[model samples]
Target: MKRPGIVLAHGKWDKPPYAIGTLADALRAAGHPVLTPELPWSLARLYDASFHDALLILDAAAQALRRQGCDRVVLGGHSMGANAAIACARRHASADGLLVLGPGHFPDWLHQQGISTDSLARAAHAVASGEQERLTLTDVFQGRPRPVRIPPAHYLEYFAADGPAVMPDNCRHLESLPLLWAVGRADAHFDLGRGYAYALAPPHPASAYHELEADHIGTPQAATALVLAWLARTFPEPA
Candidate 1:
């Protein structure tokens, strides 16, 4: 049997490839092909691409993996990357399984926290006025305020309360596929529990939810063993 190929996306505002390096290395060392793509949310790119564009980028990366000879593909990510993974699965439904770690980035939740409301309103105004210039928007990362410059239209695509980045909504819309959602106990979003998002996803017998002892940044490394085991069990290679 062909070994499964896995594409791991890095978190928002994180440096490319490195943010998920540890987990990606583990998967590669285990004889699985891995691709760690530099997503638009990376520190260098920072909202340069719309959410849909990011999904397309992921699709390209997954296709690259298939061309590398893997029979099955798994989409996985950390933090905001995890959000993108879920949204990508909903849009493409091509991957065999999903591996989400410390899933973050919920537009509705950010609005509730008063982080994106003002910026979203401004972005809306800019969009209405036909302004094509990039606007500086406030986003929160790990409880700290992060400012990002992005075109008004693109900003709204991500920060809108009913946007595609909403985790629970994306989960709800996901196609039926095996999913492994692992969250950190010490992560800020952990308190929301699996019921907030994971439970909303279409159920599959191989789906799982794990709570780890690590914090947000540490989740990928901490869950490496669990992820490898899940992959082995869910998509075992023929002996």
Candidate 2:
């Protein structure tokens, strides 16, 4: 019999079907099916439309999964997509388990370097209006890996909905839902310790934290072993 579906939300730009592919494969090998949704305005307007736009996608995905007989599920995503997945779990109270990768509250790293609220609100404006192409992701990251430029609309929508400011309160209320927060210790965009201290230990202490040595942009293959191992220990199922 197939195990419960694990809903895979990708990172940034409609959280497009990235990052979770390999993890999906792992879950599938464990007899779990996966759902990776195509978020709205992805190709052209990813940046500008990300804030309010992605919510529609999430609602739709949840409904679709229910239709396919997925009442119990897992919510998972990477980077900003990770933020969306966790929020989805919070809002819908969806999933029997929750897993987050590269999630942050306040994301001090980005703000310290200067991700202004004014700028984020502006991005929200551009997206709400559907000016996606005008968006660019040139400042999407930091360090030698090169920034992943996204359109203004996508970032705007993403910020409006899932920005660090909105995340802490939602996350704090969650208790014992088999949460796993994973990141690369070498991660540059957000520090696990400072931004996710509560997520790392007890109360919600049953949560698991794994540190991959690679930076954020590196592929899942780099840390797949640890992730799968952790998942097995934390989310075991009956045979």
Clash pairs for candidate 1: none
The true-structure Cα RMSD of candidate 2 reads 4.5
Instruction: List candidate 1 stretches off by more than 4 Å.
Output: none
Model 1 compared with the native: what TM-score? 0.97
Assess each prediction's global lDDT (C-alpha) against the native.
0.90, 0.58
State the displacement of the C-alpha of residue 103, model 1, in Å, after optimal TM-score superposition.
0.6
Task: Mark the 10 consecutive residues where model 1 has the least summed lDDT.
Answer: 12-21
- Model 1 misses residue 56 by how many Å? 0.2
Which candidate number maximizes TM-score? 1
lDDT of 1 by residue, 1-239 (tens): 27799989999889845657899999999999988888888889888889999999888888888888878999999999899989998988758999999988888988988888899999999999999899888878877878878899988888898988898898999888999999999998888998999999999999999999999999999999999999999997787
Q: What C-alpha RMSD separates each model from the true structure?
A: 1.2, 4.5
